[model samples]
Target: MKKLYILGIMSVVCVFFGSCNDEWKEELHSQMISFKAPVGSNGVCDIYMRYQPDGTASYELPVIVSGTRDNGRNINVKIGVDNDTLYHLNTEKFAVGRKDLWYRQLPENFYTFPSEVCQIPAGENVQNYTLNFNLKGLDLNEKWVLPLNVEEDPSYVRNIRKGWCKALLGINLYNDYSGTYSTTLMNIYVDGTTNDPAIVDNRVTRVVDNNSIFFYAGSVWEEDENRSKYKVIVTFNEGELNKDGNMAGSLTIKQGDPTSGANIVPVGDCTYELIVQKHETKPYLERHITILRLEYKYTDFTSDPKNPIIYDVKGSMTMERQINTLIPDQDQAIQW
Candidate 1:
């Protein structure tokens, strides 16, 4: 595959939040290898080999290279496959913890190198690693990956952070998942009790690509003092859908009352995608979501710094939407 990022001016990604700390910020500039692009807005680096254009079975992923400079010149680096760091960073950077991750393999033939030695040119800050895989060797109906970490070199440095120096390659090819699915969010109490879904169950499409979909969850505010808008973000990335044909992905719930979507927390082991008929038309909806129903109780920290609260989330939701719910702008359509 060819390079995707523009040269000489690679863009810096979004600031790592909630999990953001001075130590992490310092580590960002520290000697290490990291991805060049932000993992969409939801903080997930998901690339869907959803389809092959022009009979290509290769995917290009750009990576950032930085390390100690010996004397005046920065050290030239090589990011080879490192089997040592066999774990996801599971940090605030990816907005996901280790427990929430699903790992897979893209078979042995799919190698993570553009050549025998993937090198970062001397004085260059970026290098694109092209994943060469045989599509015919992969099962389109199942999910897979090309998991990697910064293979340690004797001369250069690598980020020792939990989430850094790692890449989870979710490789698959299918693009039928594009639409506004109707949804129902059941807010449960800490006691693990449920209630009727009060908020409107619907999702509006924000952006759609060949292999992924980004959409805002339908939200409503409750009165604590004044009405504030809460937000839910659902992202379906490449190879995210699992073997059971369930839409396996991540969700971010935000309360605007205090932080205006800044106070976000990801619920563990939540929703799944199901296909059903709606008004004589069939569409895939992210319904049948049962939250906090896991055997192991999970706890997470809130965004509060001074008086941070450690809390547990137990909720269920049902999301359903029709394909091509894209509201084409009338003006633009007329222009076309």
Candidate 2:
């Protein structure tokens, strides 16, 4: 009786396996084409590009054929600018009345799509589409987003889930000198009154070039209606080695927009000192400390455009950059 029971169990297992053999050979998932770009909380993929001297940069966008098996046939994926989606995103994120704060579509002159169609060759699972950028005169004041879409085609099945077919690339550029600096020591006061001063904890600097950066004048943040007019450009000169073996240099400060009502002038000798030191415990880490001693005076025109208010700013701003010695890529090496 026990032998007969064992034989019955073996026959049942054989029948189940034989009946499911054909199903196992069938494909379980569809072969769909999609982009590998991942979006952040803001619904845009933030891609960092190292600022170039000539104001040129390129980003390779990845296009992938998703499945358990390799692509069986060649695919020419159609691509285009999805302006409607970007418009909707801006509307959803920012109030319609706050147009100035809305993310702007990257102008056509700023970037060029190398090809409208990305080719995924047979047997390959992915391919990169090159996007060339010319940011020579891009106005960094406005938030820029490059919106892209994967057009539907009979050659391939397009993935519609998880933003696979669409990509909103938030273009961000950084240089050696461009970043947020601690402004705890910096103080702002009314043109003549110095007793009661206002201090901001931090300020962000925008990249002008490899050695130059710009920031809004004291107390005037980016949200100011006429903030661009109060731009303060700081250019670092070639450094001379100090007694401590650290590099120190004079800073050239200038107003960005001359036509504005703000009468900007340097109050004293502007300079900067850079100190480099190795991490205490981590051998593969290095720290760069940049101390900028600034003294300037500028008028805030936007608060009351008709009657501008003059403000005097003084003291130093410090920025620290950490570099990972093991990372080969300069852009990825720096802890941004």
Candidate 3:
């Protein structure tokens, strides 16, 4: 009985083996012989590569992949570069935990691949694949520098000096001699030059208003021993006063010698006044006056020829009441 039982078991095992072999052969004949990744998967996802006897090959590449996985499902990935001269390959080794994958294309000197395969669980959605590569054309690493300088122009300097003089000391000096007055005085000098003791008393009149003011004044210019220092003065006088005791007028004093074409130096400390009055019978009248004074001591004028003689001038004016107004102060005043 034991021998029969053993024989029966052997017979059953042989039939089972025979049936399995036949089924396997039939399935292989019908099914394609290749390795393939499931539809819609990427990274280390399974891919099928088939090589036929006719020297033809087929590959099923994944469409999408992830860098990481939540479950134990992870994919292994590898890359290779083949060129005429060289062949390089690398593999991804570690499992990615997140989905965000960054692949940058760098200058291609060699090929590299992920050392590990990416994996996704069954029934998982497929992901898109990202491919990156770089090509080398030229080298880049250069720098440049520039040198610059800034300075004031000489023409600008001269113009600035002239503008400053015009803004500060260039003014008209005037005096009226129609009233009972005599000897109106004026002075001129360089704006910043110091004065010497020898030429202090030089004074002259520059203008004479013979019409309304009826005054005569003349100007005098004298250079010091060194010819670098100069003194100029102007004076005016009124011949007589009118019957109404309201006899006055004005004059204008300007730089530059009328006879010698010499430019008068600008006086720094100068004051000017304007007076206005209304006559009962005549129209309103206005007057302007200027005065300049200087105090100088000897100094080396040869140091800079551009430097000129300096002086201070003071100017004032008095207007008579011609309108017969009640307020005396309001009737006649300086405009200036």
Per-residue accuracy of model 3 over 190-228 as CA lDDT, tens digit each: 345335212223332321222222111122222222221
**For residues 5-96, what per-residue lDDT tens digits would candidate 1 score against the true structure?**
54322332323343465445443444566655334343335564444443246667676665544122354455555443323333333334
TM-scores of the models, in the given order?
Answer: 0.37, 0.88, 0.18
Query: Compared to the true structure, candidate 3 yields what TM-score?
Result: 0.18
Error of 2 at 32 (Å): 2.6
Point out where model 3 deviates above 4 Å.
Answer: 1-245, 256-262, 265-306, 315-336
Best of the two (1, 2) by TM-score:
2
Maximum-lDDT candidate: 2
By TM-score, who's the top model here? 2
Q: Which ten residues in a row are the worst by lDDT in model 2?
A: 19-28
- What is the Å distance of residue 274 in model 3 from its true position? 15
Candidate lDDT scores, in order, read 0.43, 0.88, 0.27
**What is the lDDT ranking, best to worst?**
2, 1, 3
